[model samples]
Target: MLKLLSTTLLLSSFIYANNVSEKVEDFLDDKFMENPRLKSVDVTVSDVVPLKQLAGWNAYIVDVEAYLKAQPKRLIKQRMIWFSDGRIITKELTDMQGGESLTDLVKPPFKDEYYKKENLLFGNPDAKHKVAIFSDPLCPFCKGFVPGALDYMKKDPKKFAVYYYHFPLERLHPASVHLVKAAAAAELQGDKNVIEKLYHVQINPQERDVKKILKAFNKAVGTKLTPKDLNTPAVIKQVNRDLDIANAVMVGGTPTIYLDGKVDNTKKKYLKVQ
Candidate 1:
């Protein structure tokens, strides 16, 4: 009976892996054209390990190694999450508290030094919940998520303190570098709402004029910022620091949020305010 039980378990594991593999392939096939550079995408689900029970949902983070048949035909590594109820999260996950993950791997170490007082853009400095937002000024998702996060924190001032970091995706949003640098410069000048206003502004893709953006920045944040302000040594250094921290944690997208230094993979924890 013991032998039979072991065989059953092995078979179940195999079947589960097979299903996950198929799902990943289906996802890639459907989203093939999402990236213009991809002539073809070949993905392999190397492993599917069960993770902690996440808020009553059985969750697992899958390891995917993909080959992008682009101009140079490059290979890439990615981690994706899968839920027992057919839900999938394609973002990276990290645990800053030194806890063991589902795969028995420790999350990347997060330094508290990174969240200095001067670096904070919103919320009470002494608040218990320290949230950090790494975002791009021109990202559409950042527009929605950044404001949403701030609004959520406002509800409980005593419990939450948020930090802001600029991560401009220049390849995608050409005007982002200027906007981010301007935000850093505005911060230096004590313009507290510069980043928030930038997020709220409506940007037309065809007319990505720097002068127009500067005018809007001045109007929204009550500061007459010019192109020269964005080129200051201090502003450049601050932006570089943000980029370095982001790269260490393998952040590939905008609006990456960390609550108390850990990557909040279950975004429901941060987004849904109870």
Candidate 2:
């Protein structure tokens, strides 16, 4: 391997003896034009060429390693990234911010109250920050917001208050209604910590004994209620409120979230994932 590399280097040196820089550029240009492997490389280059002019997009932050390696001086926020070295790597961009906008948040014209008043549901009443989450009980997308979301909150609990609501696509999964109802009922038991656990952890409806969920709910979050307590009228009322809010918000699917009401349909704000 070492001898082959040495021979290639010697041959390249001989080929480029007089016009080294020109020869190198011509070689690369020819490779760029003719090689299919280089064609794939061109795609990466075209995707990022906008960066040269700083005509940005929301996808520049993806493939942090490739972006960093390809353009050591650049800072990208969204989109794909790639380059050839001795290794290969890539990533899909998330968390879009608009082009040429230095601020992480985009300005929306309406007051947050507009979205909140329409969609807000089960959460701590006195909580400072509000997040409305639309989730199907049985959907994997909804389940993605689990322990990861909790960890995100732990960073700054005071700034993150999540409102859980069910947008169960019951026609698709008949079992979703029961799970949504149980989850809503769990919320009223006054321990969001436990409710979130049950929301995130207990997903399987078949093996899901109501007692197991209630047990995990109890053990993880120390709620002040028996399973029967969730059957009360007040709990029923709370569950109804959650469903009503989910309906009002036009929650189409599970795991849809409005962040502080700033990211929603009243405005055309594209959601940035965590």
Q: Please, what is the TM-score per model?
A: 0.59, 0.43
Model 1, position 88: C-alpha lDDT score? 65
Q: Could you give candidate 2's per-residue lDDT for residues 1-274 as a string of tens digits?
A: 9999999998875453323323333444454455342222212222211222222232121111112444545432212232212122223222344343222232222234433432334344455666666666567655665445645654554555555555666676555555555555655544454445555444454444656655544554455445676677876666666555554333445566666655453321222333
lDDT tens string, model 1, 102-125?
Answer: 422333445787886767777788
Per lDDT, the best of the predicted structures is 1
The local distance difference test score of each candidate is: 0.68, 0.46
- List ranges where model 2 is wrong by over 4 Å: 1-129, 200-203, 206-230, 262-274
Tell me the TM-score of model 2: 0.43
lDDT of 1: 0.68
Error of 1 at 213 (Å): 2.6
Provide the global lDDT of candidate 2 against the true structure.
0.46
